[model samples]
Target chain A: MLDNLQLLFVWAPVMNVQMILDGVFVGAVFALSAYGLALVWGVMNVKNLAQGDFVIMGGYIAYALFHPLHGMGLPTWVIIPILIVVAMAMMFVFGHIVYQLIIKRVIDQDMFTSLLATFGLSLLMQQVINLIFGPEVQIIDSELPILTAFDSFVTIPTVKIVSLVMAMALAVVVVIFMKTSRTGQAIRATAQDPRAARVLGIDTDRVYAFTFSLNAAICGAAGVLVSMIWVIQPFYGIVYSVRSFCDGGGAGQFAGGDRDGVRPRSY
Target chain B: MKFKSLKTMVVSAAVVASVSMAGSAMAKVEGDTITLGSSISLTGKYATNGLHTTRGYDYAIKVINEAGGVKVGGKTYKLAVKYYDDESTPARGAQLAERLIQQDGVEFMLGPYSSGMTKAIAPVSEKFGVPMVEAEGASRSLFTQGYKYLFAVLSTSEQYLSTTIELAAQTTDNPSEIKVAMAFENDPFSLDVREGVVDAAKKYGMKIVIDDKLPADLSDMSATLTKVKALRPDVLIVSGHSKGAATAARQLEEMKVSVPIIGMTHCEAAKIQEKFPKAAQGIMCATQWVEGIPKRDSMFGSASDWNEGFKAEYPSYSSVPYQSAQASAAVLVWKEAFEAANSFDKDAVRDAISAIEMETFYGDIKFSAAGNNIAKPMFMRQIDANGNYNLVVTADDMQFPRKAGY
Candidate 1:
């Protein structure tokens, strides 16, 4: 134990500014995905256990587009953002279909029911993704250059900085959409009081579907960013899921009583 | 209604007949064939290596049969394999091993790919009293269990990285001044590799700067790389299968953390040189077989000959992975034992295998009391300048270590 402490203290000076910078950049990606999870949980009143699988699926979509285009004469700067938008759009449609076929049934049920349902969905999606992509780990091959500082003690890839900017920009767009748009208002109203919103002639079911799709779009965007900056595989979905769940809880508390005045359950 | 019922009866009879025919085809030994059973990971996480292992077995069996089969008691018997997809799950591996022994009546068995799967299947082989020669599973803990029925042809995981230390000592005049940093995946195989490196480093009087556990998923290693950059260890060693190796290579390049000597396991098996040649160059790795070995035998001939035949048959097979070579050697060991025993009896074959000692194109085969290969020495290879592995160190040749650079 003494030796352990001594070692830790000796290594303490080495754990410097660069480590924190890396953690913050990685954590930003997690926050983006978690915001999506929180959006769905808050509006639809359903927990999506397959949230990470959706993210991976989106990553594969971006990879499918980027890998082929990478061999072409197209530049990464031209292909990456375009493919990300395409992936988000594709996931939006996928999420709508998923909600119509499976999640809609459990949306109004107890949290346990939705949990079990989405858990099964998560397993099915993981296997399907594995079959489609084969089990090899893949990266987007963004070919973005690395940036070094402090005589190379601190290293940051340009792709990571791009991903952080994209994540923050998306989060801001989501917040603005929720505060302004008619559909977003319907979603917030339903989350505030579904029975009252139904009595007010709002199509609560459509609102739920739209909110779920929007959440999936957000996840898809985050996944595209993740594919650009880090490595992804079929089985690595659960780690992202756990990270997002933690982020969702923290974000829920921080934003509590500001907009909807509803306390996020202690998930 | 009566005519429909008759049709249904005829269909049912045809189905039963087909089922029985399929079962009989698998069950029959055909008077001139010896069938060995295995539960390989054909469809799961270990599928890539599992494919290599199975193909090795197939190629070896084909070669043996073409060479007039195994002669036992003046009768030649062709070799056949009966394998099931274990799905890379231990429980499934054990279940299939039992099925192979009891239901299929296989007299001999071959082990699975990973050490975990082998550990699960070893007890079943012991209980059924069938001798198994395994090539892929290398976890040292699997040997210490004292199971007599199980044997592994590959060197134990503990020996995987000892040669890196040895290579370091040969390259440097002051070996004690060399500092090593190791990051190993916290799995059975990698943990064993860590143990080997630590022991070997101590023996060579080297200093260990950082020893960290890579998480199971191997998703992130930035923090570890950051520390590595600061400490600037003389050598950086990683042992986390293909994914871990890829992570190390990619992250090392991204972080610009260059060590003088970089050694890793599974650089060839994972095809890292082909995938990321820029990052892969100058990285030395431990392997079970190299192509230019002088060892030869009647069944497989020399290493180059075996590789040529394998590539001719499998045109897309770029490099001869160690998994396939060791797996083919496992079959050769079985053939040698069967021929020496001069009988098909299980007890006689087991005895012959226990007392057997020989060298093949893959390597030497001599099992210790713990059923691990002791005769074969692991060699070191470096990814050369042209994105191909060059044999840097063998039993006969030891060269200067290349420094890691872009």
Candidate 2:
């Protein structure tokens, strides 16, 4: 019986299944953070240096809603959606302000200015978060039990499961909105060729504003997903930003003699 | 007329040279004030540890100075400390060590807290012929380097963990056969501790039920604890820092896992109890300093008195990190050696430091033949039911198990 049990453990097919699921759970968060970076690159042809900071900001909002606001009868599950909406709205406003005040001036300049400007914005945002939250790490939780099977061969944290589902749903919504929305189409056209897009009925200035806002919204969604599994801190933004840059997945060139707004690596 | 004026000029030059030479000697003591250099990490990820250690040095210096420093060779001299922050990087640590020896001219050196940084700086000690009193680093290879200059104050990680395991074996119903689980960070100190535990466990015919590396930035340990619970080991040995230990304990408590956590050097900090008040209780860790050790052998007044003094001085600082206490003891060593040598000669002070065997605030300390500091005395401390750590076993205690981990 002992020999049989040992053999059974060694030959367990369920072990492979568990490892794959664990990898998937870990990969989903990575994909979600990347998607946000991709979206902004896809829309504006301007890589937001502060993308990571926006993610961290979204996390803080989620944490505040889940823990502190939960005392006022708000359910934990519902807090994530509210956090997403608030993060999106705030980021949208921030994007508009940043573009009109800073980005518009350097839209025609070399990539160095936009890169440096965005990086400076990122650092400033990180410091601001640090001042407000202090340096200690914080997390969002619904106090759920961990899910496991096969005598601990397969382990799944409930937070990761929920985050995976939420991230996928958000990604789908963003994709659909870009395809069907009137403003998204004009932004796409403007991303392709600002001069040609201007000759068409598209307002290039308005497209830039819309594109920046869309990127912020996507970032806000990613932040909501991140807070579910990982502890968030102000310093975390730089790491996420570097990872996004390294992956180079979102923006590129299109056939219409225009820059594809989704070209993540090019800009 | 020309001869007279030339003689006068030569006499004036002679007088000026003699006066300047006298001034230089007066400013620097030959052997009285022992000059020791430290290449410690004072600002970086390890800064929090270094900041508290600086206090320990100050406290030790204050007491020694108040007592008129070390008395040796019929003259007394104060201890002089020269320190440079390495920023917790190995390259920086080596550079600082080189500077301390070549530029500052420290007779003897004190090692840093982390093993990797200490190893990086180890060559400087050999090159300069300045003996190093290693207090915090526990890498056996450091002491085993065969260099006459390197002397370790604290016991190696393996020795401590092995002793703890021996103690646990005594408590178990089956002395010869036991199931053990090991969890530690993938760092040098913890890795050494893990290796020692595994070796001892195997030697004692104990089965290792589980062994895994906890991620460095791991905030949640519930998933890991569940694995431990399933393993159902008779003992769970956790090798990590305060945060990691507390998190492990917290998760074990939440999961209703009942195995006792045998901790590494990381859990010795007072902040562990404050961080995980309930979970920290009953966990055991080994250290060179303990607040509950009997006052006669310890250097810092009484253990409790020293602890109280630290609390009063820096209320925000966590309970004493053992490395800080080691730094305190190092200052006393420097004072004693300087007094013994009575000259600032590096060779003389190095010899004096090697000869020192005294009862300091930490306990009885002396350097071994290899120049590794033998001053560090071990104590087995346990966080009690009230979440307070008390010295359960001292080196002097007859009941204290000495062969590692009991």
Candidate 3:
């Protein structure tokens, strides 16, 4: 036991700083996906179990653009932003279709029904993605250099730094849009009380559809950032879903103390 | 109305009964062919390696048939395989194995792609008293259960890193001064590899600076790599599947952690050399078979000759991964056992396999009491700068102190 203690002390200092840096970088990606999940759950009142598959699908979209476009001699700067935009646009349309085909039926049902429906959707999406992408692990080649600091004890990849900044920027933009935009106000009103919002001439259905699409767009952008820095697999979406579910639960607790005092249903 | 309905029901029941009787009369095994069954992961996470394993099985059967299939008791029977897709799920693999035996009436069994799947299917073979020759499952724990019917052609996971440790001890002037850091996935195969390395490290009097368990999905190894950089271990080893290898290679390059010798499992099988050339270079890995090993057999001929034929047949076969070679070798072992036993009876064939020992193109084939290939030795290969594997050490050769590229 004393020998084990000696070994533990030997690794304490360096492990602390290194692990903290690693956690922070990885946590930023988690925060982005979580925020997207919170947005849809807060507004639509439908628990989407396929949230992680959406992120994975978005990552594949970005991969398709980056690998093929780079092969065609397109510049990295030209490819990265285009990849994000294409992923978001594609996911937005996909979200709209999902709402029309499945989410609409479960929108007014009990929470358990929605959960079951979306869980089935998650399974379907995983198989479809596996079929299309061939189940091989893929990582985007950002080709970014590494940056070392603090006498090389702290090493950070430039791609990760870029992803962190992009995540923060997108989060800030979404927060501001929710605070000021008309559609965002309608979404908030519908979440507070769907019947009242409908009586006030707000189309709760349109608000739910738009809110779901916006959530997918946010998750899709996060997926793009993930592809740039980390590895992606067809079946990796469930991990993201579980992480986002935890984050969304925490966010719901914090939002429970809002001025409106509308308690979010816990699943 | 009652008389007409009763007559219709009786007529339908008679028709169904006749169909069942005819189906039962159909022969599962004929005088001309002997059938073996397998549950392969043709479409799932293990799909890529599963394809390689299945192709290996097919090729070996084709070659054996061309050479005049297994001659048993004055009769020659051609070989055929009946397989189902397992989707890389253990439950599904077990179910398919049961179906292959009870429904398809196959006498012999072939192993699945992964240790987990093999663990699931092994009990089914044992319960049915069927002998299975598996080529891919390498977890040492699989053999520890004392199952009589299960046998593996590949070396166990414990031998994966022993050669690297031996080479490191020989190459380093002061063995006691060596610090080794290892991170292995928390799975049966990887845990066995970790045990092997730790045991070997103790034998050589080396210090284990850091030991970590990689998560199930292998999402990140930065924390482990970070400690590795600070400790400045003389050698770094990681044991996992393809995903773990890719994660480590990517993180190592991102962190710029350089050690004198880096050894990892699955570098060749995963095609890490081609996928991440810069990060893969100078990494040593253990492989079951190398292309030009000085071993030959009448069945598959020389290693190079087999490789040449494989490439010609499978034009897209980039590299003869150890999985495919071992899979083919398993079939050859079973064929030889059949001919030696001179009977297709399960008891006779099992006895022949238990006592049999020979050399083949894949490697030497001799099973220990645990039914593992004890005579065969794992080879070590280093990924060169040109994104190609250079066979650094055969079974007996030792190349130590790999040059100063991390």
Candidate 4:
């Protein structure tokens, strides 16, 4: 460990830049998923343990698209962003169905009940994914050339840069949507109090469904980035769920509210 | 509508529970069939190699059954394995072994995948006094346990990639000045492989550089590669299972971290050459058996013949993995032992397995007192530009200073 510290600090200090680049690439993925978790937990008050599974599910969609589609003589850069959008739209619909079938019932129950329900959903999604995709470690190779710096010591894949920009762009779009859109206002109103929003003529059920679906869409976008950069398998979801909660809780605390009321306002 | 959905879920859960209970109550031997139980890594981290080992067992079973089956006590008995997914965890492996013996009523046993898995199942099989011949799981510590009921058909893990260190020493003019970097998984199999490398490196008075224990998931190691860039070691050796090989090959290429000699175990099992042909070129891969091993039997013909048959069965493979070859060989050992014993008695089969000395397409299968296949020697093969593996026996056979095109 000491030798490693010395090697990084003394022998090859330039490698520090390479390590940080790797962190930024992975961090972008975590941030997107975290934002999704913050949205759902803040709005619906549903402790979604299956949030990570949504990310992995979205990654599978990208894998199904980018892998076979690219083989049919299509370019990667053109297909990647399009697949991300496609995954988000598909997951939004899936989340709506799930909300109707499962989440809608649990919303009236206590937080513990919602936790148990989502935990079961997480397990169900994992096994279903294993059956569909098999238990192999899959990656959607973007085939984009890597850029190098400082005499090739600091290497960066072009896909990671694209994923970072995509993540930032998605974040900006979400912030703007939450701030100005009429549906976004209803979502915040419902999050503050469903009874109050209902009295004000906002359909609380519709607002809850929209908020949950939006969170899934954001997670789907993060998952597309994961496919381009790292490897994904069925059982790797639990790790992502943990990170999402961490980022969500951290973001919540930083905004100074019980359930991050200030951040949910800017959701 | 909600009531109907909940009712459907409840009924499905009941059906699944009942089906699983029925699945465990299979017979050991019934109506001209001999059942051997095995807990394989059908899911989890080791799933890739587990599938290869399963194919090996299944393909061999098919060949043996077609070739008049195993003739024991004047009755021909078809061989079938009752497999349970151990999920690449030791605790699960042990539980499945007990369940295979107790609930499944399996008298004879086939080995699970990997040394860690075998270590877990061995104790359970030994307690039940069931004779087990395993193809995977090559840790030397397994052989030291004095397991009379256990027999392994593959060379120990210590011999897995130690040959690369010797080759490195031979290729270098200054053997004493050789530098070695190792990244082994924190599992029993890889840890033993690391010990063998440390011994080999010591003989040449080599300097030990970066040594990292990869997590069980074997997910990310870009940090290790970053260290490799700064240190620039003469030799880089890695061993973890198939996932480890995939992660290493993926990151090594992505980072463009090149070394003169880089050796990794399970490259064939992972199909690194086929998946990432450019990055995998010139990388040395260790194997238990190859097509050109110059061995044959009437059952499987020659090593090349077995290779052809396996590729025919699983046509997706560009090259056959040694894991499958050794797995098929383990099944052959069971057939031989069952015939030699001429009885369905567990102790008779155990004695038969211990006294066995046979030759097949996978190579010579003879067990030592400790129950490891001391007859076979592990070989190192270099993946060529076209993704074909060519056996590299000596230092000169290697393409020095690996050029993994960044």
Q: What are the lDDT scores of the predictions, listed in order?
A: 0.82, 0.66, 0.81, 0.87
Off by over 4 Å in 3: A1-17, A251-264, B1-34, B42-48, B62-79, B313-317, B338-344, B394-406
DockQ of structure 4: 0.53
Q: Candidate 3 chain A — worst ten consecutive residues by lDDT sum?
A: A254-263
Highest DockQ among the candidates is held by which one?
4
Evaluated on chain B only, candidate 2 has a TM-score of 0.81
Residue-by-residue lDDT tens digits, candidate 3, B22-61: 6433323467887888999876557667878998999899
Per-candidate chain B TM:
0.89, 0.81, 0.89, 0.93
Segments of candidate 4 deviating more than 4 angstroms: A110-112, A251-267, B1-26
lDDT of 1 at B123: 94
Better of 1 and 2 by DockQ: 1
Give per-model TM-scores.
Answer: 0.87, 0.71, 0.89, 0.92
Best to worst by lDDT, what's the order?
Answer: 4, 1, 3, 2
Stretch of 10 with least lDDT, candidate 1 chain B: B395-404
Per-residue error (Å), model 4, residue A16: 1.1
Give the per-residue lDDT digits (tens) of candidate 2, residues A22-87. Answer: 567656656656666665565555677788777788788777666666787786667767777887
By TM-score, the better pick of 1 and 2 is 1
Q: Each candidate: fraction of true contacts kept?
A: 0.36, 0.02, 0.43, 0.55
Question: At residue B279, what lDDT does model 2 achieve?
Answer: 50
The residue-by-residue lDDT of candidate 4 on A223-251, one tens digit each, is 89887787788877877898888788654
Error of 2 at A234 (Å): 7.7
Stretches of candidate 1 above 4 Å error? A1-15, A108-113, A252-264, B1-35, B42-45, B58-87, B99-107, B312-317, B335-345, B394-405
